[model samples]
Target: MLGSLLIANRGEIARRIIRTCRRLGIRTVAVYSEADAQAPFVREADQAVAIGPAPASESYLVGAKILEAALQSGAQAIHPGYGFLSENADFAEAVTAAGLIWVGPPPSSIRAMGLKDAAKKLMAEAGVPVTPGYMGDDQSEATLLAEAERIGFPVLIKAVAGGGGKGMRKVDAAKDFAAALTSCRREAKASFGDDHVLLETYATRPRHIEVQVFADSHGNAVHLYERDCSLQRRHQKVIEEAPAPGMTDEVREAVCQAAVRAALAVGYVGAGTIEFIADTTDGLKADRIWFMEMNTRLQVEHPVTEAITSQDLVEWQLRVASGEPLPLTQAEIPRRGHAIEARLYAENPHTGFLPSIGRLDHFRTPSDIRLDSAVEEGGVVTPFYDPMISKLIVHGPTRQAAAAKLAAACRAVEVYPVKTNAGFLARCLADPDFLSGAVDTGFIGERLASLLPPAEPSERVLQAAANEMVRRAGVPPALTGFRVNADPSFRVPLDHEGTRYTAQISPGAQPSALHVVVSGRDFIVFEDGEPYVLTLPRVEAGPEGSDGDGGVESSMPGLIIEVMVAVGDTVSKGAPLLVLEAMKMEHTLTAPFDGVVASLSVKKGDRVAEHVLLVKLDPSEVK
Candidate 1:
């Protein structure tokens, strides 16, 4: 085992790796950027080192800075947790050259699977089932167009160099293929510094199933069953589970063998995942599955695998990197129960799932389940990293029980000030189709209307807000909330989510609480359960707050990555005006109605706060 190790990552993943190292008596070092100086991971580490500023380019992504931190901390090994440098082959080589143990697979394996086109060819040559795609070296526009036609309509143009759905697009017709390819290449170049892409046949109803494979330096490899990550939105996974709900024994055995074969072919070491796209239009079968790609490090969804197998995967990575053999053979590893993981993100599902940034006034989750979180009460959720606030992991004797438990936990979550997708996750778990295991990649999109219902503040919530206001004023109970001489039945004015409400709070069975009756529903207020924090509408008094004048505003705090309109340029209604990068996702703001661009206030590469005026159509008159 490593005497001391430095985690070359940040956030929850770094904390996760540190947890295992501590249990194994291995000293841990943490590297942080300026933005994360006060983060919890830094406090948990045995030693901490400041790498660079907040931007990832100057911080986590810099291999030299990470190496320096490792050396200064006397770390014998470096664990690339997952994101930033985990799959960077050159970084892995650099670490080994520095005489430090790289707690990941060999550099050769990473290089083999770094590019999607080349990796598919390699997998095919090694007898693993690969998707039919164009892996040719030609990069000309003519060649790509012909390949897309050959692959048939509804082809997927994906960047060969990166993952996380960054440089991927689906074109359903030949006319859209050219534009999609161009946009995909541009995003790919910006994200991975590679403009190359591959065309593959798009599965109509795809289920993302991946097999977890482990290998050691002793040339032995084994598979740890599979995880179904079909619940996705915008190509990013939302929920994942082990022992796929509808998997059969025969199909499971075949997929596991194929995964083991792929790992051995690359002489893979440590923990890795072989992801496949299952065409479940018919249903899961051995022949219907094809290799999509391979993640060359521990995945964000590895906790579900751990919950089911009752084995610590990070401990396996450490032992394997320290020259140990496989801890358990394929036959000896046991799968006792079902486990499911939901990615709880700091975003508002009611508002197109736009990422939210601010301080978490109240952040709480269930204590019974396994919650891999990084934030606490009063912590700030910056717009620099991924928006995932935490992951809620639960286990049960059966899939049904696990799903129910996960849904309950999500409902129990209490997050304030910053909005979240907790309610959406709870609805997903409670959906009948999801509960019955009839799910696919398109599930969220198909059932989005029902999942994101209109927000209606309950009477209890209104009463709580009104009561809190009175309590803050310290008014006597007899004189509270428009009370009369003797009657307690009175109307209390309150505001929440941009609307005003006059809650009628009367005396309750318990004098400590209030009874609010509205729309024939009786709601008893309490101090526990769902919080009722009133969000009074802000009344701005400057140019930024001007309304009813065709002034385009930024709805969130983010960086303006692309400005589509120039000053005095005419744009139509609903036309995209600019793209804002926030919380690790891009949001395109559009013109509210047809108008001319009279003035433009922001340009590309500018950081903006919420409600900042970006453009004003009637600027000449207003000024």
Candidate 2:
């Protein structure tokens, strides 16, 4: 076994690797950027080193810095925990050249499967069924447009080097193809530094299924099982589960065998995942499944595979890198009950999933399940990294039981100041179609409104907040009016999201288990994983405070990537004004109402902080 290891990534994944290392008696060294200096993973490691500034380009993505950290800390192996440089073949080679073990697939495997277009061609050559698409070398716009037409109207434009739903777009009509292609290319260039893309036919009822395969230097490979990651938003996975709900024995064999073949074809070692796009319109048949791409490193959803197989994948990676043989044969690997994982992100579901950054103030998750978290109660969620704060994994005897347990766990999540998608996740698990195993990639988009929590606090939630407020004010719950004939309740004025409500606090009223947290003059009431931040109404504020002043402010700290409108531009409601890249995602700010752009303060490439006014709009006079 490797004596010591260096983790080259941050957040929950770093903590996850450290956990298995600790169990195996391996000393762990953590390399962090300035932004993550005080992160939970840094404090949990056996040793730590600061690499560079907060920007990933200057820190985590810099191979030389990471190599130096490992050398300085005397780490025998470097574990690229999934994201930054995990799949960078050059980085892997650099690590090996420095006489340090790279705890991942061989550099050759990464390079072979790094680009989607090339990987698909390679998979097809290896006799593995691949999705029908154009992976040709024609780079001109005319060729791409012609290819899209030939592939059919509904086609997917995917970046050759894309993953995690970035640099991908689906166009349904020929008229919208050009604009979509331009946007896709721009994003692809910004994300992967490569604007090359491939066209693929978009499945009407697509299901994302991936097989978890592991290999060793002894030329042995085996698959743990498969995971269904169909519950997605913006092409990114929202929930994942092991042993897909409708997978059959025969189909499982076919897919799993194909995955192993793909691994062996590239001489892959260590852990990797072969992602497939399945046409579920005809069920999970063998012929309907097609290879999409290969992830040459550990995946974010690997825990579900670990739970179902009763295997420590990180341990397996470590062993393989240490020149060990496969621990179990294909048939020897145990497969058990179902498991589900929900990614808890620090974002507001009410605001179209905008990333929310702030101090955690109060962070509490259920204790019974396995939780891999990045931030704790007092930790801050900076905008420099991914918004995912934790992942909640639950295992049960059956799929239904597992989904139920996961849903309950999501509802049990209690966070404050910073918003999260816990409530949205719980609702997704409880959705009738989801529970019935009828989900597709478009499930969330089809039922988004119903899945979101209520925009306003319910009557019960308001009452609970009022009760907590009264209790905190040192007033007894059973207190009655001083007048003989006076009513037994007093009105408490509360403001929630700029709306005022007068809650009649009845004396002796029983308080509900709404999980209320008191913060100064505000009471944050959590119900079903949705937080309702309520504050005591200010006596001097007026109704106008709720109205918008036509000033467009940055919701979070980010770099301006594009400005679509000028100062004199007349735009209607929902017209895109500019694009802000933050937290590894691009957000387009749109006009809130029909207005004329009166002022423009920021330009492309300008880095702005949260709440900085970027544009000012005036109501259109002609309207």
Candidate 3:
């Protein structure tokens, strides 16, 4: 076994690797950027090194700095935990060249599967079933358009080097293909530095099914079953589970065997995943499942696999890298129970899932289940990297039980200041379609309205707030003058998101069981995993602007990518004004109403902070 290892990543995954290393008696070294200097992972490691500034380009992505850090810390191996340089073939080769063990697949395997276009060709030649698509080398727009037309409508435009749902778009018709292609290529170039793309036929009911495969230097490979990651939003997975709900033994055998073959074909070693897009129109059939791409490193959703298989994957990776044979054969690996994992992100579901960045003034998750968190209470969620705050994993005797437990765990979450998707995840887990196992990639989009938390607080929540308020005021039950004909109650005027409501509080009423946190004058009540902020009415004056003011402000800190309108430009309501890139996603700000652009304050390539005014407009007088 490797004596010492360096984790070339940060956040939960880094901490996760450190945990396994500690159990195995392997000394661990952590490398962090300025932004993560005080992060939990850095403090937990036996040795630490500062790489560079906050931006990934200057820190995490700099391979030279990481290699130097490894040399300085005397780390014998480098483990690139999932993202950053995890799949960078050059980085893997560099680690080996420096005489340090690379705890990942061989560079050759990474290169073979790095690009979607080339990987598809290799899979097809190896007799592995692949999705129908165009992977040709013609870079002309005309050629892409022709391919889209030939393949029919509802085609998917995917970047050659894309992962994590970046650089991907789904076009439903011919008229939208060109614009979609342009957006896809631009994002691809920004994300992967490769604007090349390929086309695939979008399935009617797509389910993302992936099998975890491991290989050793002794030319032995085995499979660890499969996981279902179909519950997605904008092509990104929201929930994942092991032993897919509808998977049969026969189908599971077929997929797992195919995954092992793919690993052997690439001379793969260490942990990797083979993602397949399954058409579930008639249930999970081996024939309907086709290879999408290969992830050459550990996945973000590996916890679900670990929960069911009763194995530590990071230990396997280290053992294989240390020249050991497979720890367990395919038949020996056990699959015991159902497991589910939900990614808790620092983003607001009410605001189109825009990434939220701020201090975690109050943070608490259920203690019964496993939680891999990136930030702690009082820690700041900077806008420099992925917004995932933590991952909640639960295991149970059955899928239904696991889902029920996970839903309750989500509802028990109490986070304030920084918004999260806890409520959204709870709703998704409890939805009827999800509970019935009739889910697809488009499930969230189809039932979004029902899943979103209600705009206004319920009567129960208001009563809880009022009760808490009364308790805080130190008012006793006897203080309320005894009434002869009615229950003694007092009205409490409260404001919630600009709306005022009067809650009648009775000193003798039953105290609410709902969890409530007090932040100064604001009362944050958690109901069904949603946080409702209620405060006493203020006597301050209101802002002097109306909707007609047409002032546009940045929703979050981001870089301006495109400005579609200019000063004096006439635009209608909902017209795209500019594009802002934040948290690795693009958001287009639109006009609130029909108006003429009165002023512009930002340009392309300019970085702006949250709530900074970027544009102003004058309402159209003719209207």
Candidate 4:
């Protein structure tokens, strides 16, 4: 085995790799960007190296800098965890040429599956069941339109080298084809440096199922069963599970065999995943499955596979990279119980899932389950990388039990200051269709309303906040605001997400408890249970010409990527004014009302903090 290894990534995955290396007695070196200097992974490493600045393009994605760090740290191997340069074929080759063990598949295999168009052709030749798509080399718009016509309506336009929902569009009609194609190509070029796309028949109800396959230099490959990743939003997976629900014996055998064949065909080494889109229009069956794509590195959802198999996949990757054969034969690898994993992200579900960045004032996870995370209570989430905070995995004897446990776990999560998808994930787990296993890729969209319920703060939560505020103010009980009928009563108003709620508090049965009602919802409150709610003093509306009348402030801290307006441009409400890039995504700032731009304070390529004024508008009075 390699004596020392360098992790060419950051966040939880880097920490995850470091943990395994420590278990195997391998000294691990961690590389970090300026934004990640204080990251948990960097502190946990045996040695650390600073690559470059915060931006991925300048740091994590810079193959030369990462290689330099690895060599300088005396790391004998480089493990490119999941993102950034993990799937870059040239990086893998360069690592090998530098006399360092690359803890990943061969560069040839990565190249073989790098582009969707080429990989589809290869999969077809390898006897794997591939989706019927136009993978031809013709780049003409006319040819693409013709191919879409031939494939039928509702075809998918997917970028040849894109993943994670980038550069993908679904066209529902012929009239929308051209505009969709143009937009897709623009995004594809921006994301992958390739405007190439392929047309494929869109599955009516698809379940994303992938088989984990690992191979060794000895040409031995074995499948580690499958994971069902049907729950998704915007083509990004939200939840995943092992041993796909309702999977039959025959279907499992066929899919597992096909995944092994695909790995062997590429002469693959180390860990990889063969993703298939199974048409569940009827139900999961062998013939209904078709090849989607092959992730040429360890997957983010590998924990579900590990939970069921009781095998450390990272250890397997190291063993294979060290020239060891398959740890277990095809028959020897056993699948046990059911496992589910939910990706916790620093995003607000109410505002179109906008990425949230701030300090995690109180971050806690259930002690019973497995949590792979890099954040602490006082940690800060910046706008430099993916906003994923942690992954919560649970295992139970059956699928229902696992689902129940996971739902409870989601509710038990306590994240403060920065918003998270914990409540949203809990709603998904408790969804009726989800519980019945009748899920598809479109489940979240179809049930978005129920999933993101109205934020009606409970009476208890409001009273707790009011009580805390009173205690903090050192206000005497007899001095409660405008006492009624010789009794102490207080009305506390709190602002959350731009909405205000009034909490009516009075003395209750005990000194610690309080009788509280929030927005007419009644309940009793004590000091324990549910997390403390942040209470902000209500802001009284000022005159129309007062401060902040027309000031447009940034919702989050980010870099200004594009500015679309000038100092004197007249604009209507909701006109796109600028674009801010934050947490690896773009958010468009728009005009709040009909106004003329009186002053512009920012320009393209400028970094702004949250609540920073970007533009001031001179508003026109309305009738």
Candidate 5:
């Protein structure tokens, strides 16, 4: 085993690698950007080094600076955790050439699998079944359109480099193919710097299954079964689980053998993933599986693999890099239990899945399972990098237990200020269709409304909505001793999930009962220390507050992302003037009525507290 290793990444992945390193008695050196100076990973490492500035280009992606850190720290090897220079072939070569172990795959293998177009061609040549599409060198627009027409409609245009659904678009018709290609190319170039793309026949009801392959320098390789990451949004994985539900033994063996073959073909070393698109419409079969691109580095969902196999893949990587042969055979790796991982992102889920940013006033995730995250309660979710706040991972003896635990865990997680997809993940977990494992890439948008929380309030919410008035200029609990002689009721306007709630609070609106609403619905968060929240139908925001602020701002607590108009600019009735991306959805700040924008108090990218002044529109200047 290597004595010391420098981790060339930040956040949860870097911290994850450090954990395994410590278990194996490896001294670890952590490198961080300015933004991650006080990160958990830095504090956990044996030694920490400052690489560069905050931007990834200046920090994480700068291979030279990372290599310099390793050298200056006197580390024996470098571990490129998942992102950044993990897939950079040149970086691997430089690491070894600089007389340091790369602690990943051979540089040649990274080069072979770096580009999607190139990898697809190689996989096809290696007898691995590849998806039928245009993988040729023709970059001409007309040629791509012709290829799409040949492949039939509903083809996917994907970036040749990088994943994360960034530069991939599905074109259902020729009319949209060109535009999709242009947009994909721009995003690809901006994200991965490779505008080269490949087209594939988009399989209906496709399940993404990947094989974890490990190889050592001594020409030894083995397969670690498969993981199903079929439930996805924006082509990115949402929930991933091991021991795919209803997998046939014949197909499993074939996929594993094919993965081993693919690894051997590239002379792969260390841990790498061979992803395949499974057409479950005709049941799981070896013939129905098509090769997707191979990830050249450690995967984000590798923890699921570890939980099931009881093997530390990072330790294996270090051992392999040290010229150690395979410690165990293919049969040695055991699949013990089911593991599921949900990527918790700072995003809005209502209007559209837009990224959210801001300071996390309070973040409390479940302590029951393994959670991989770089952020804390006070961490800032910057727009400069990926908006993933954390990853909620759970494992159990059975798939049902795993799914149920994940659902319960999501509901219990409370992340304040910056919103997260905790509710969405819970809904996805509880979806009868999802629990049945009938999921694909378009699971979110296809069943958006059904999976989303209903836009209605519950009675318990009305009873506890007395505090909503206090938050918006109502009488405080300490001074609200005087009560009306009649019914003693007052309306507290509560807005959540784009709808308003008029809570009839007794004692003429006491300060204790605040409303927690979501999507035009109100829920009583049994602050009585209860587990579940009681919901109710929403009422209109009546004339309750002293201020003339008529606009229903943020219904729930979240961060505002984009302010679209200046003061006195808007004139339309419902034109979106500002965008509030909360919990992975975009809620537009629109005109309350047909009027002109009057008083705007917030700017773009400003983190506004819930119910803060977003935009005040004059309800008069209408026709």
Candidate 6:
């Protein structure tokens, strides 16, 4: 085994590789950009090197700088964790030429599957079921339009290179095909440097199920069942599970075998994935699953596979890269219980799930299950990289148990300041269709209403607060002596979500009775309502930092992509104030609201940070 290795990537996956390297007695060298100097992944490595600026093109994607770092560190091997140049064929070849082991599939295999259109054609030749679509090389608009019409009405235009829902578009009718193709081609060219696209018939109800396959230099490969990545938003997976929820025994076997065949087709070695789109309406079948794509590196949801198989995939990658024979036969890989994973991101769900950045004031993770992360409480969630905070994974003997555990684990964990998708994830796991195992790729949008719990308080909660506050502070209590007076009325103050809720207190019951109503909720005062409601929402902590987490001024740095407000706009709390597009993702700024703009510091197309003043407002208007 190699004693030292260089990780040519950043973020959580890079940290994950370092962890496995440590366990295997391999020293790790981490490469980071200028903005990532203080990143958690950079600090966790045995040795670190500065590559370039914050932009990935000048930093992580700089193959020459990466090679220089590896050679300088005297590393014997390089591991490209999942993204950036992980699937770059030339990078793999360059590492080998430098006398360093490339801890991934061979360069030849990456070349074969790098392009979606070509890969589909190859799969068809290998007898692996592929989606019926146009895999031809003709890029003329006329030819493409003709193919789309012949294939069907609804189709998908996917980039030949790149993944992660980037450079992909869905066309529902011929009328929209031309515009979608243009947009898709532009994004593809920008994201992957290749505008080549392939059209595929859109599945009526698509379920993204992929099989994990491991192979060794000795040409031995085995399959590791499959994972269901059906639940997603904006083409990004939100939840994933192993031993797909509604798969049958026969179909599972056929799908697994097909994946094994696809892997072996290219003499594939190390950990790889063969993604398939399944039609569950008629149940699983050998003919029901179609080859979608292949991920040429360790997947983000690998922990789910590890939980079920009790095997370390990272170790397997190292072993395979060492030219060793398969460690275990196909029979040795057992299908155990169910496992599920949810990606927790530092983003907001209230407004189109825009990425949010801030200090993790109270970062807490659950210990009942496995958790993989690279950030900590004091770590800055900079817009220089992916906003994903961590991945929460859980295992249980049954699917129901796994769902239950995932829901509880998500809710039990707490993160302050930067809003996260944890609440959204918890709601998804507890969803009825998900629990019943009747899910599909369109689940998130199909059931958006019931799944999203309205951000409104219950009447009982308001009543309880009013009763408690009035009894606790007698300064604003009803003037009528409770025991002696027949009737009485009083007004009291309450606060909620940065808004004030004035309560009206009414005397009821025989003697010495108290009843209060706030926001149409009734509350009865017991023991003068002292203990129940200390202060009704307590809104007037004016001009003070009331952020739930430790008040950090700026969480990340990015360009002010757009500014929606100027001084003097009476916006509500939670309204979009502006947007910061960084790291290929958009982070939105929200108004503290109920205040007029006092000043403006930054405008659209300017650079800003967590502490930077884009806009200022008066705190008094909030009252």
Candidate achieving the largest lDDT: 3
Please write out the lDDT profile of model 6 over residues 491-598, one tens digit for every residue.
Answer: 444445555555545555122233332222223221211112223321111232124221112232346777787777676666666776532335565655456556
Clashing pairs in 3: none
Stretches > 4 Å off in candidate 2: 476-479, 539-623
| Alpha-carbon runs more than 4 Å astray in model 5 | 453-623
Number of clashes in every candidate structure?
A: 0, 0, 0, 0, 20, 8
Q: Could you tell me the lDDT of residue 567 within candidate 3?
A: 90
Better of 1 and 3 by TM-score: 3
Model 1: per-residue Cα lDDT over 1-623, one tens digit each? 78999999988899999999999999999999998999999999999999999998899999999999999889999999998999999999999999999999999999999999988998999999988879899989899989888889889999999699999999999888889989999999998899999988898989999999999988899999999999999889999999898999999999989998999888899999999999898899899899989999999999999998989999999999999998999889999889999998988876788999999866778899999987878888999998998999999999999999999898778776677888788889999999999989999999999987346667666766555444443434443223134355444544555566666645441233532212111222322223344532222212333355777775434578998888777777667778866423466776655677887888899876545678776534322
Local distance difference test, each candidate: 0.83, 0.88, 0.89, 0.83, 0.77, 0.78
lDDT of 1: 0.83
* Superior by TM-score: candidate 3 or candidate 6: 3
lDDT string for model 4 (252-307, tens) is 99999999999988889999999999889999989889999999999999999999
Assess the local accuracy of residue 455 in candidate 2 as a C-alpha lDDT between 0 and 100. Answer: 92
Residues 143-257, candidate 5: write the lDDT tens digits: 9999999999889999999687789888999999889999999999998888999999988778899999999988899988899998887678888988888888888999989
lDDT of 4: 0.83
Q: Native-vs-model 5 lDDT?
A: 0.77
Better of 4 and 5 by TM-score: 4
Query: What TM-score does candidate 6 get on C-alpha atoms?
Result: 0.77
How far residue 606's Cα lies from its native spot in candidate 4, in Å, is: 54
In what order do the candidates fall by lDDT, top score first? Answer: 3, 2, 4, 1, 6, 5
Deviation of model 1 at 113, angstroms: 0.2
lDDT of 1 at 331: 88
Residue 558, model 2: lDDT of 56
Please identify model 1 stretches exceeding 4 Å from their true place: 467-488, 509-532, 535-623
